[model samples]
Target: MKNQQLQSKGYLMISSTQTIRIISINETFDPQGVKIVYGQGTFSHYSKDGLVEDSIAYRAKGAAAVSVAEAGVNASGVAIGYLDIEVKDSDKGYKNKICTLVIRSFIPTTTANTTFVPTTSAPISPPASEENSKQLVNPVPTVAASNGYVNTTDSSNIPF
Candidate 1:
């Protein structure tokens, strides 16, 4: 019999606290007929000039799917948490590596703060009234001026 070498064990890759605005959550059956749930959103942060946005996604299955649902990620809203990825052997083969999102703590339908400083190049005005403000789905969070870092407050349940 030929000896087969095992692939390198899976390990965490990148982990960062991010403010995500979940645009949609989708559920579908995989090729194996297993239910898979995932979501697409935008990751926003403040730069030296102004707010910046980027697309983000997460896959939550099994009990994690339930937790994501409970966290209210099913709708369009803001959530802040540690978004991390793990490099692991793909289900198809050991030679391939798959990056999977490791769900940490996510508090949904909430804003980290209510302060925003628009870029000087393109100025943006705040909502005119309370009614108008209520319609804004993506609310800017407060970032530390010195280093552009925002604090994550809801970490009581986070393991690390």
Candidate 2:
């Protein structure tokens, strides 16, 4: 904290306040084929007036590092911990640049084949599941019940 010496009667001067906001963030899961037991992290907002190391035009590009110190369960049911994320400013003082978050997929080479065949049989066919579509059981028929259907029952037959 910087302080200015008080003159005559002791008093403070030049009080300033700053506000920060998160522009964009890219966060993804990293599964190492293990189960994560716990998860904890932190993020930061970047601005010229904040505690950023460097900034300009009241805006700065920065990132907040986060870690899953304890670990937790992920979508793949793998034990993951020590998660890390960086808090970064999007503007970076460039007016023409558009800010966006990106998540990259990690692909492994030397992949192994899961299924085996005699080179004559075709690959397994995907079975139709409920997620693919909803089964219509005893469906109620309608001439035009749903929305966006225009009724053309003629002017004379039309009931007022």
Candidate 3:
């Protein structure tokens, strides 16, 4: 399937089919003193129409929390990572669903001394010229899979 960044909303089953750029990481503790880590980043994916972009915030706990913390410590400015999130029916009286964050991979940086500065303006796409015609079309065939999953046969055309 074509790789795409998973959505970061609660009560949804999602996973990163491709690596995502971590713009920032923050660490905190829960009421019980358990460590929690939060990562903020931008996720982009190619849709049948065009490029789709969204802001993502992921929370990690337990073993995943430790991994995110380690990555944040080593990262000079940003980090690149993959995440898997599963939502299940919650047993807690106060909540209806529980979300779990799994860190598949986390790297401090892809290039030396690199930094990411988020802009308030929308992303500018290249002009639709003849040379860029191929990029304007959907690169893969997508099918709706069960449980809110989108499947693509060729992920090679997915833009990271």
Candidate 4:
């Protein structure tokens, strides 16, 4: 082995493989109300002669495609932010070797399509009153943040 290509003692190499790899990512989302969201898991590294830098820069195209999108009134995807990776090699019990990455997959854009043809037109239903119209609404009003919540994922928000 060459003197410049040797691994150091202590937490070096991903697991004694003499090539410990470090990773970085953007784990959260800032969907400016586009009705859609996307994420990518980027990773890359070149073996160093010594201590590895804590932060690595990912190529703009290096970000892996998370290709997740949802549409509709109240839709959402994965939690936004970094990727949570678990690494092990008889070190630190293989727990939390990497930081917790949250996936920002929720981006509110448009609501449900109103043009959906009614199922069987209610057989010549009588004109709906103001109170009745309110009740007929598909989504019941609640304390939902004018912004959607992660508790539920509605249609249109999903690529399907």
Candidate 5:
């Protein structure tokens, strides 16, 4: 079936195998007053070289944001596995999204989930590469003096 038809029926699927190391979750309100739990973290995907750095600000805010927040808190160093992008009906509009992170079976081990270190062989040159793909991944590390957090991604890639 076509993706659009599938989406209309309340299914959003990402065909990639991905992983996310959640750094932080914050509760905020949208202008429309909906509770938005913003999650920012590092992302990696299985490549021929094993897990390679993919993006940052792996924001998953919406229906599953609450769960993401909870997991981050209770599961110290929680690593969300088998992550996928899903879209369902929402007040916002058709195909409103919630990044769905699933647990296949066993719980994640502590070491893998705690920290996110970029494994990109080269530094990310932003606004060019990211813009072409229309997805914002934290290509560079933020200065420590600025904020304690790793870094939030640019606004370009968030599909909402």
Candidate 6:
């Protein structure tokens, strides 16, 4: 058997569903956080009936590079974590498959607070594309460096 390498591209045309989890965030003028998000990507294939298929296997692993000030203004975690990714699809036979998906232009609609787990509190679940004015308190605070706590975000200034 020959060893095979694979890569594919999925396209999200018009609109698609996406979900992102903020693993960790650091305090800074422009705070950067790690995120793992998956959503319906570009159409990688089509059925015999001319129906298109969206790939959920592909994901965008990137940073939530937003500012505390910006977060305060938006008052939405989903808005703060919004991202635009451009990369290959992580699916079987993707490398060998023909790619027609526009990876760079994939954007979702109506991002809201679906899941949030503060360090100290239980998980917070809110509806998508809605506003929740609940305050968030960091249950487990991080160590302070010369600058300050990296994962620290002033709850008073933010709305969860």
lDDT of 2 by residue, 34-120 (tens): 322112212234577885432112111111112111111111111111212233556776345322221111112211223465657
lDDT of 1 by residue, 9-128 (tens): 443335555556655567776687655567776776789979888677776555545545655543433333334433565677665433334444454555333457876575788888
Candidate 3, residues 15-132: lDDT per residue as tens digits? 4443445557688999998887876655567899799976566666666566666655324223234444335546675434332234544444443345789879888998788785
TM-score of predicted structure 5: 0.32
lDDT of each: 0.54, 0.29, 0.54, 0.32, 0.53, 0.34
Of the two candidates 3 and 6, the one with more favorable lDDT, higher being better, is: 3
Sorted on TM-score, best first, the list reads 1, 3, 5, 6, 4, 2
Stronger candidate by TM-score (1 vs 4):
1
Q: Top model by TM-score, which number?
A: 1
Candidate 4, residues 2-51, lDDT tens digits: the string is 21234443323221111112122233433542222232322224466654
RMSD of candidate 1 to the truth, in angstroms, is: 22.0
What is model 6's C-alpha RMSD? 23.7
lDDT of 3 at 23: 58
Model 1 TM-score on a 0 to 1 scale: 0.39
Candidate 1: what lDDT?
0.54
Q: Which ten residues in a row have the lowest lDDT in candidate 6?
A: 1-10
Tens-place lDDT per residue, model 6, 109-133, is 3233345776776788876654655
TM-score of each: 0.39, 0.14, 0.36, 0.16, 0.32, 0.21
Off-target runs (Cα >4 Å) in candidate 6 are: 1-33, 39-47, 63-105, 110-160
Q: Per-residue lDDT tens digits of candidate 5, residues 67-126?
A: 565566424234343445556777665676555444322233343236668785877676
